[model samples]
Every structure is written in structure tokens, then in C-alpha cells.
Target: MEYIHGRTGDQILGSTSIPAERKGVYQYMATAIQKLLRIPIPPELPPPPPPSALNNDVFRLVMFLDTEAPRIYQNADQLELHLNTIFITAHDICFTELLYLHMGSIYEQLKGLSNEPMVFCYGDIHPGNFIINDDGHITIIDFSETSILPSSFARYAIVSTSKLSRG
Candidate 1:
């Protein structure tokens, strides 16, 4: 990983939040993502990585319990749980509808854009994942989740798919 010399978007948006300044930062992020979204489709693209584990209820329930209440795991608590979403079902009789929506919406939206022209994606496009250069340009970072997907599917991969901003 190369050292990127610049202030992160989060740093730029410190404590005093201003309307115009935040808007500019968001615009920069959109512009940078847009640039990646316009890359020419590759000739023979590799299959995308496995969908997020959040797509599976058993997996997600285990994850949720692990996050929301680790005591359940520490004590070896055996609890049956399910997750259901308007977009997808993580299990037969799902219960965690709200959480499922984040992962499922991405899956359904991506499935719908399968045939569209592909584009390059940094895959993680949140403010914390980008740097604001001295020249007012935004630099996207964290290529660990980088991917190439249909242009229409790029947005689903960039933002709103992760557990960020949701508590």
C-alpha cells in the first residue's frame, strides 16, 4: 500500500459542519466514482467475489449476535434466528428484515445490472475511504475490495452496501 499524502474526507469535515463544504466533498466523491464507473468494459472479466455473508441469515445472525451481544457466543448460547428482507430472504422464516435490506438490495440491484457495460470500482467509496488532495481533487483509497462490474451495478458496490452508517 502506497502512502497517500492528503487529508481524508473525514478530516475535512471535522467538527464544524458547513453546508457548502460538505456538498463540495460529496461532489468530489461522486466525480471520482463517476470517473471509475466510465472505464471501458474488460474483454474477459473474472467472476466477482462471493456475495457478503450478510446475504445468509444463519451467517448474519451469527454475525449480529457476535456484534450486538458477544455474551451469547462467550457462554455458548444456542439460539435459532432468521433474517428476512423485502428484497431477499436470508433464511426460511426470516426475522431481521431491516438488516437484510442492506445486503439484499445490493444483490438484487446487482443482478438486475448484470448485462450492462462493466466499469472499474474501488468497491469502497465512503468518505473515510477517500482522500482530499491539496488541489481540491478527491483520491479514492482502500483498493482491497476493488472490483470490475457492470456500470449499473457499480453504485451498489461502492456505497450503501456495507454496515456503515447503520447502528
Candidate 2:
């Protein structure tokens, strides 16, 4: 990849000429995330969300999770518990707020959003990889580990790194 000319999202988001938060920067980050996931998946994803039928989006997500995530789910109750706890925690911390909530009941703060489907991810997302060019466009660098995987893994990467960043 050519050396992109611009400060990364991390640099611009920290102490610098530009303030950390901006509508344009967030917009670019969201768009860049979508584009990053569109990268080719090394392995084929599990079945695409079941197309028509009484199946809504949630059912398909559950189907995917039951297969890929921690192989600990036994019954529906067990699965629900695991999904509610781990997946919910990861998403709340990594995706929604862009900052992990370290207080009690953080998981409950985000209740009904555990159905994020699998997509090709950068496999490694951190402050540095998200780039913001001089032209106000964003890009996700590091295609080395990009592939189709559970969104939880990507979210986990963010949570892990953000903790380090916080420290």
C-alpha cells in the first residue's frame, strides 16, 4: 500500500491541532469501517442470513453464534446467558460508544443489540489503523489479518487494545 499522506484517526483524535470529536470524523470512521469489512474474506462466511421465511434478522444471528462463538452453549437458556453476557459486553464497550464502560452493569446499558452479523473485518482495529487523511476522508489500514469472522472477535480486539490505551 502506498504511504497515505495524512494523520491517522488516532493522532487527530488525540491532543493536536484538531479536536478529538467531530461529526465529519465520526462519519468518515463509520464509512471507513464499512469499507474495511467489505474486504475479501479469506474463508466463506457461514450461511448468509436466511432469506425469506418467517426468519427475522435475529434468528439468523443466533444461528451463526451457536455455531462459531465459544462452544459452551448447550441448551437455549445456556446460549442466551452466554450471548447476553459476553457478546453484549464486548459490543457495548467496543462498537456503540467507541469507549468501553468500566463500571457496573455496563452490559445492561446495551440490552437488545447482540445480533450483529458476521462480516469481513480488519481482524485488528486500533487507534492507529483508522486513518484520517488531510482531505477529511478515513481509511482502515492493516489488511494482514482481514477476513470474515464473528464481529465479536473484532470487537474483542478493540476492547483489548483500548484497555491498553487507557492504561
Candidate 3:
């Protein structure tokens, strides 16, 4: 909850709000803002490459997460921890039905792309949940359900089928 307040796109992007003459001041101020708010600096990163194949995108995302996990986790098993958790032991009927409908649609679309080369991905990929720096670097967050499933449509399927589901 606390982390969210500091890393929102608005917060980082808003660094530009500082006067141009005070770029150096803004840099330190940004760090101070994060510190004052108790927000940890995100992992240092190299610039992101130009958009490439979907497989590469997903792989890049996973690599980013994998890199961060150790700093965020004290041990290997702890990597599986969830920051916010809720389970539908007795799933709501409407929610279940809606999810089923969506899943079916997603399945059909994935099947069509199964023959292509692609990267594996956990189903969700929203920008708000993910973070990108001005360097063009991006990181994956909310790994409650991430994996490397087999696929042919570019490691992870591009914004075609899964992308629509994201919207």
C-alpha cells in the first residue's frame, strides 16, 4: 500500500514538474521525495531497447522481475510471497461465470496463435501495475500469477488476444 503511493507513474513522471534550471535539484529531490515517503528506489536499470518481438518483451519483463526478487526477498522461498491476498474459496457465481467466458475467449485466441513463435507470460500486464522509467526501462510487478508456459506466438502473445483481455 505504501509503495504504491511513491511509484505511481504520476510520481516519477512528475519529477519533470521541478523547474528545468533545477534538474540537479530535482534529481536529489526525487530521491528525497521517495525517501521522505519511505519508498525504496527501484532497481537501477539500463535503457530499454526498442520494441521487439513479444517473446523478447515477456522475457525482458521476467528478467527484470527476477533481478528485483532477490533484493526484495531475503530468501528463495520468500519470493513466492504475496503483498495483497484474497482467494475465492467459494467463488461468486457471477464472477466465476464472467471469468469463464473471458477464459474461453482467451483460450480460443491463444490456440490460434499457438503455432507461432512467442514467449510465455502470466495473463496480466497492465502499465499501471508495471513501472517504466524515462530510460525506457520497464519492470513487471504483481507477480501473484506469473509463469513461463509454452507458446509459439512470440514467447508471450502480443497485444492481439491477451491484449484485448487486458482492456
Candidate 4:
């Protein structure tokens, strides 16, 4: 395992204490997602461990890790707040009609994702999972939930549930 030294995106946003920096956080996150999308999928991956190796002891260990892991937000309120902030920032940086159009396509794709082309995605992209490296670059962490799904799923998942309207 390699060591990464720096703050999480959440920490950077919290410490900056500036509303405008929140927009930068969204841009940083976008860059990270773009980078993640560019990574070539490994042609072959190791299979899961045998059931014998996943005995009670190992199960307990895995459960502990899952429950204790740091997450982006603990509940809906936090998620809503963050999404609201991101949307506001995004709106300021780009044309509202374009953003709406992009979001509309995402929603439409999500509605029919099962029939769409798929791609490997991080599966989970929250502020806490993104590391702001010491050199000021965004790096995505945590691949436990990675999977291949509709290419539009990521975009839809990012902003679909938000209160932002199609119009």
C-alpha cells in the first residue's frame, strides 16, 4: 500500500472557510472523476478469497472495517447541504441551461441505464473519499465499491438525487 500525505477534500473545504473555495472543491472533484475514468481497467484481477478464509474471525474483521471506515457524510442532511453547495457553485461557473441539459441527459440515461453502454466507475464518490495531495492534486481513494455500470450512472448518481430541477 502506498502512503498519501495530505488532507481529504472535506478537510480542505472545511479549513478554507471561504464559500468560493467550495466551488473549487467541485472542480477538483470533477478533475478527480475525469482522471479516474481515464484509468485503464486491469485485464485480469485476482479472485475473491475462499470461504474457508472468510470464517467467523475474518467476517468480524471485515465488518469492523466496513463500519469504522470514514465516510463523506453521515446522513441525508449533510448530503443535501453538500449537493446544494456544489450545485450553487456549478451554476456560478457555467451556463444554467447547459448544466440543466447535461443533468437531464444523466437523468434520462439513469432511467434506462440497464440498456446503456457500461464503464468502470468508482461506485462511490464523496468528499471524504477524495484526497487532496500535498502537491495540491485530487486523488480518489477507496475501491471497495468499484464496479462496471452504465457510463452515465456516475454523472446521474452525482447530481440526480439533488433538488436541482430539469428546467
Note the Cα lDDT for every prediction shown: 0.48, 0.48, 0.33, 0.48
Candidate 2 collision pairs: none
Runs with alpha carbons beyond 4 Å of true place in candidate 2: 13-31, 38-116
Sorted by TM-score (best first), the order is 1, 4, 2, 3
Better of 2 and 3 by lDDT: 2
lDDT of 3 by residue, 105-155 (tens): 322211222232222344344333445554534444555434332232112
Per-model clash counts, in order, read: 0, 0, 14, 0
Residue 108 of model 1 has an lDDT of 30
Give one digit per residue, the lDDT tens place, for model 2 in 1-167.
58878877677666455544644555676677767556554332356622211122222221233323334332233443554565455663333332233222433433322354445544455557778877776667866545343454456544555466578
> lDDT at 51 for candidate 1?
25
Q: Which stretches of candidate 3 lie over 4 Å from their true place?
A: 1-118, 152-167
Candidate 2's displacement at residue 34, Å, is 4.1
Give the per-residue lDDT digits (tens) of candidate 4, residues 2-37.
987878877887788788876777778878777766
Q: Model 4 off-target regions past 4 Å?
A: 40-115, 160-167
Model 1 per-residue lDDT tens digits across residues 27-138: 8888988887776654543455222222121112212333232222111012212122322444322223332333363333112233445456455556787798888867
Name the better of 3 and 4 by TM-score.
4
